[model samples]
Target: MTPYGSFSFFLILAVLLAPTVILGLQGKRFHTYNMVVSIVALGIIFASSLTQAIALIIFTIWQVVLIKAYITYRKKSNANTIFYLAVILSILPLILSKLLPFLSVVNVIGFLGISYLTFKGTQLIIETRDGLIKKNLPLSRLLYFILFFPTISSGPIDRYRRFNKDFELEISGEQYKLLLYDGINKIFRGFLYKYIIGYSINHYFIANLRFIAHSHFEHHLYYMYAYSLYLFFDFAGYSAFAIGVSYIMGIKSPENFNKPFLSRNIKDFWNRWHMSLSFWFRDYVYMRFVFWMTKKKWIKNRNLLSNLGYILLFLLMGVWHGLEIQYIIYGVYHALLMIAYNSFERFNKKRKWWPQNKLTHVVAIIITFHVICFGFYIFSGQLFHKGV
Candidate 1:
C-alpha cells in the first residue's frame, strides 16, 4: 500500500493512521502500530506475488544477520579489515540485484526498496563502526527500522536515530490537529501534482517520444519542458505524500524537494532537488573520498582533490543509475560543470568587476535552469539516442 500514488491507498492509510493519531493524542507512543501497519502494507503488496517478496525477505534476513554480527564483532574489536568485509557482505546482494539482469538471469535478488534499504543498512554499519549506534539492536527492532514503510520504496531517506526520536514523541492535541490538517493538505497537493499535471505531461511525452526519437535535429522544447515538469511533479509529489503521511503518524519524515527550479546554480539545484539522495551521496561518497585522500597525503591541493572527488562520486552516481551511455554522460556532465564553476569562482574573485546584483542573479538562474534542462534531456535518453 504505497502512500503516494493512489487515492485508495491514502484512504486505507488514513484509516490506519486515525487510531495512531488517537494514541499519540493520549500521550502514548504508537511504535508498535506503526511497525505492524508497515509490515502489513508490505505483506499485502507482496503476498499475491511471492517471487519478488521472497527476494525482499531473503535480503532483509541477510541484512539483519550481517548487522547483528557486525554489532557483536564491534563490541569485541573494531578491526578495519573485518569491518570492510562485513560491509561488503551486507551489500553483496544489492550488487547482485543490479548486475544479475545483465548477467542474463531473472532479477531474483532485486526488489523495489533494495537500494534505499541498503543505504540505511550501510549507514548503520558505518555508524556502528564509528561508535555512533553504541548498543546492539535486537532482530525485531532492526526489522522495524529497515521495513518502516512510508519511506521504503522511494525515500526522502530517514535515519535510524531520527525515526526512533519521532516514534517516541507524544503529540499534544493542538499539534496533532495541526499535523492532521497539514498532512491531509499535503496528500491533496500530491494528488494534484502527480495525477493531474504530472500525468498530463507524461502522456504528452509518451505521444511524442517516438516522434522526437525519429526526428534527428529538430529541437523539441516542449518535450524537454514536459519531461522536466513530469519528473519533478511525479517524484516530488510522491515525496510530499510520504512525508505528509509520516507527519500524521508523528514521524516528521525529512523533506525531498524545495523549489529546485529557482536554483541559481547546479550546486544550488542539487541542494533543493531530490535532496535526501543528493545529500546521501555527498555525505557518504564525496566527503569520504576527500577525507581519505587528504589523510593519506595523496593530493595536497584542495581544489584538485575536490575535482577528483566529484568525478568519482558522480561516476558512481551514473553507474548507480544504470550502465547506460546517457547515464554515464549525465554524471560526467554535472561533474565537469561543477569543476568549471569552481574554477570560474576562483577567477571571478580576483576580478571584482563581474556583476553581482539582481540582474546577474536572474541571468544566472536562467542559465542554470537551461543547463539543468539540457542535462535532463541526456538523462531521458532522447537526444541522439539510437532507437527501434
Candidate 2:
C-alpha cells in the first residue's frame, strides 16, 4: 500500500492520538505511553510495508543513538567525532539500499523516505554537537517526529532546532481542527497536481521514455521537456502533500516551493525550488565544506575558496542523487553554471556594461531556463546508456 493511502493515513492518526489522549487523561503529567505508541506504530509500519519498515527502523536507531552519544560525549569535548561516526553508520543502510538496488529483494530499491529522513537524522546529530539546543531524547518527541506519518514519506526538511521548538507547543482543539482541514485541502490539491497534471503529461505527452530513447531524432528533445515538466509536478506535488499533512498535526512545516519556474537566475531558482532541500545542503553540506577548507588552509582567499567549494559541493550533491554517472554529470553541470553566474555578478558590480532593465531580466530568465533543461538530459538516466 502507498504510504499516504487511506488505510495508512487513518492508522497513523489513531496512533498519534492514542498517546495524547492517554497523557491528557493521566493528570497531564509525563506518561510513558508515547514509547508504547511508538512500538505499536513500528509494528504496524513493518507489517504494512517494507519501505515503512525501513523508515521506522532508521528513525528508531537514530533516536536511540543520539541519546547514547550525548550521554557518552557530554563529558568529552571531542565527542562530535563519535557522533559523526554514528551518524554515518546509521545512514549506511540507507546509502547501501539506494546505491545497491540489485541487492534488494522484490524491487525495493530504497525505503519510502530514507533520503528525507537521513537529513533529519543528520541534522539532529549535528545540532546536538553544536550545542544549539539539547533535546531530552524523550519518547514523546521521538514518536511525534519519527512516526509523525505526515512527513514520513516526503518532507519539507525542517531544521532540528526549529522543529523542537514547534513540537513542544501544546495542541488545542481549535488548532487541531484548523490543521486537519488545511492539511486535507493541501492533500487534495497535491493529488490534483500529481494524478491529474503529472500523470497526464507522462501518459499523453511523454509516454514511456525508454521507447523515445530508442526512437529516431527530434522526439528526444520533446521527451526531455515533457519529462522535466512531469518531474516538477510529481515532486512538487509530493512536497505539498507532506507539508499539508504536517500542518494538520499542528506542525508548521517550512514551505518547499515558491514559484521556482518563475525564477530569473540559477541562484533564484535554488532559492525557490525544493527550498528545504537546498537550504539543507547549503547549511549542512556547503557551509561545512567551506569550514573544512578554511580550517585546512587549502585556499588562502576565503571568497574565491568558498566559490570553488560550492562547485565541488554540488558535484557531490549530484552523486548523492544517485550512484549513476549521469547524476554526477548533472550536478557538476549545474555547479559550473552557478559558479560562473556568481563570478560574473561580482565582476559586473565593478563595471557598468550591464543595464538593470526588464529586458535584461527577461533574457537572463530565458537563458537560465534553457540551461536547466539541458542538464535534464543527464538527470534522466537514459543519456548515459544507449539501451533502455
Candidate 3:
C-alpha cells in the first residue's frame, strides 16, 4: 500500500480523483471533496498497520492541541520560551522516531510521513511566532493541510500560507483544462522516469555492474554513477506523481526538480535539485540561524557566519535522513563542498579569472556533476558497507 507504488494504488487514486476532476472541470471549488478524499486515502495508506494508524491519530491530536494552545497564547504575548517549546514539541515525535532505533525501542510514535508532517507543523508554529499567521487556523483546514495525501509521505513541502491560498482558489474552466493537461503530462513523465528508465537502470545497469567490472575501483565508480542517476529518476518520478496529483486536485504543488544534472556549480545544483527541500532548509534553517546570530551580535564576519550556517543546515539535513554514519558523512561532505565553492567563487569574482562562456559552462557542469555523484556515493553508504 505504498504511495505511488502499485497498480491498485493508482486505480484507487483514479477513483478518488474522479470527483475532483468533475468539480474542477466545471469551474467549481473541490476543497471539501478533496479533503474527504485525503482522509480516505490516508486511512487506506495506514490501514495495513493498525498500530501505525493509531500512531497517526494520536500524532494528529497532539499537533492540533499544541497548535491551538500556541495560537491562543500567541494572541496574548510573544514569549521566546513558549515559542521554542512549541517548535520542540511539534518536532518531538520525529526526533523520538529517529532516536528510538538506537535505544532498541520499538517506535510507537513513528509512522510514515511523520518527518514531512512535522515540517509542516513546525513551519506553522514558526510563522505564527513571527506574526505572519495572525489568525487561528480552522481545525479542519489545519487537518487537511497536515493530512494531504498526495505529498504527505515526501514533499515539495508546502507552506501553510501558500497551501491555504491554493485551497481557497476558485479555478475557472479554462484554468482547470490547462491544469488537467499538465497533470496528466506530469504523471506520464513520472511513469517513464520511474517505471521505464529508472527500472531499466536499476535492473539492467546497476544490477550487472558488479559482474562487468574487472576491479573494485571500476565497480564502485560505475555503481556511483548508476546509483546517482537511479536516485534522480526514482525520486523525481515520485515527486512528479505527487505534484501531478496535487495539480489535478487544484493544489499546484511546487516542482521539486529542474535540470539538476546540468548544474554548473554546487550552489546551482542545490538550487535545482530537490529544490523544495533545499529551499526549505535555506529559508527556515540557514537564514534563521544567520539572522539569530546577527541579532545576538555573536559574530561580526558575515561570510564566516554564512559558512557556519551551511554546515549546520546540511548536517541537520543529513541527520534528518537518518542517524547513520554515512548520512552524517554525506552532510559534512556537502557542507565542505559548499564552503569550498563559496570561497572559490569569491576568489574568482575578485580576480575575474573564471570565464563565463559556453565552453566553461559545460566544463563546470561536468565537474559539478562528478562532485555530486561522489556525494551521492557517500550517501548510498556503499563506501562503508562494501569497503569500497
Candidate 1 per-residue C-alpha lDDT over 194-225 given as tens digits, one digit per residue, 9 for 90 to 100: 99878877886646676655563443666676
Ranking of predictions according to lDDT:
3, 1, 2
Stretches of candidate 3 exceeding 4 Å from the true structure: none
Give per-residue CA lDDT, model 3, range 35-61, as digits (tens).
899999998999899988999999999
RMSD of 1: 2.3
**What clash pairs does model 3 have?**
none
Number of the top TM-score candidate: 3
- Of the two candidates 1 and 2, the one with more favorable lDDT, higher being better, is 1
**Where is model 2 more than 4 Å wrong at Cα?**
5-55, 102-110, 171-178, 208-215
Indicate whether candidate 1 or candidate 3 has the larger lDDT: 3
TM-score of 3: 0.98
lDDT agreement with native, every candidate: 0.82, 0.69, 0.92
lDDT of 2 at 59: 56
Minimal lDDT window, size 10, model 3 = 379-388
Local error of candidate 1 at residue 100 (angstroms): 1.0
> How close to the true structure is residue 12 of candidate 3, measured as C-alpha lDDT?
99
Candidate 2 global CA lDDT score:
0.69
